[model samples]
Target: MKNLVNFKVAVKTRECLVQAIYQMLFNNDSVAKVIDQFKDEHKTKKVDFKMFSMSLRSINRNKKKIESILTSLEIKNSSMELIDKSILFFAINEMLFGNLDKPVAIDESLRLSKKFSSPESYKFINVSLDKFFKTLS
Candidate 1:
């Protein structure tokens, strides 16, 4: 994984990552198109493109595992909205596969939930991650 915090960088790196994941979720375009569209639509002038790119790659590689974790956490795909599902994908990928810290993953997921999902959906994000991580221990 890329060292996003190693040197001077934009603070919205995490946001851009989440946005890329959300784009992958909602848009029917290919990953390349979604990334290009995200960058073009958001006017991401200073965003860390590596962060978004690596996150999308990780999410795509472990997509089945991420979705399986979600199912084990009882977040049924049929019951959840697209935004919440996207949050799960991003957070789980970070927690399980990416190089980010666990708390950072949870916190960023909550932030994304607040921004893109229902207010109360953050609780589900928190609880699900907690449960999933606990099982790993």
Candidate 2:
């Protein structure tokens, strides 16, 4: 029998989107690699690969800006986990580059954190995103 645990059923949630973004970034060195990696997994879910691709592109495009913003928020500490950093990068990319709503972005980031990271990380992610938003106005 196939391992059901590896198969994620179809669902549209910010967490999944963010996860996809993180996976695409962390697992692959190029778009072709990402597509190859996700090709099998995505068959079980109705994920918007286009959206994930766009997010990846956006993040790469604004990589410098995003890094500067994160640095400004003092997130350069090596203590942070890679998952937490991915969450922050996804949240920041969607909020600042994609023009997603602040509340929705923050809430989604929190939800993602609750699922993927520690409870303690939610507050830090929220406050950090909030600070980044403040710079926009």
| Candidate number with greatest TM-score | 1
Residue ranges of candidate 1 with Cα displaced over 4 Å:
1-11
Once model 1 is optimally superposed onto the true structure by TM-score, how far is the C-alpha of residue 6 displaced, in angstroms?
Answer: 12
lDDT of candidate 2 over 1-137, digit per residue (tens): 22434323322434555665566557646655655566566657666666666766777778688778789888874887777878888888888777567776777677778778987988888888888878877
In order, what lDDT does every prediction score? 0.77, 0.70
lDDT by residue (1-137, candidate 1, tens digit) is: 34546633444766676667777777655678877876787664666777777888889889888888888877778888887788788878888888878888887778778887888999988888889878777
In angstroms, how far off is 67's CA in candidate 2? Answer: 1.1
lDDT of 1 at 39: 72
With candidate 1 superimposed using the best TM-score fit, by how many Å does residue 103's alpha carbon deviate from the native?
1.5
Evaluated against the true structure, the overall lDDT of model 2 is 0.70
Residue 62 of model 1 has an lDDT of 92
Best-performing candidate as measured by lDDT? 1
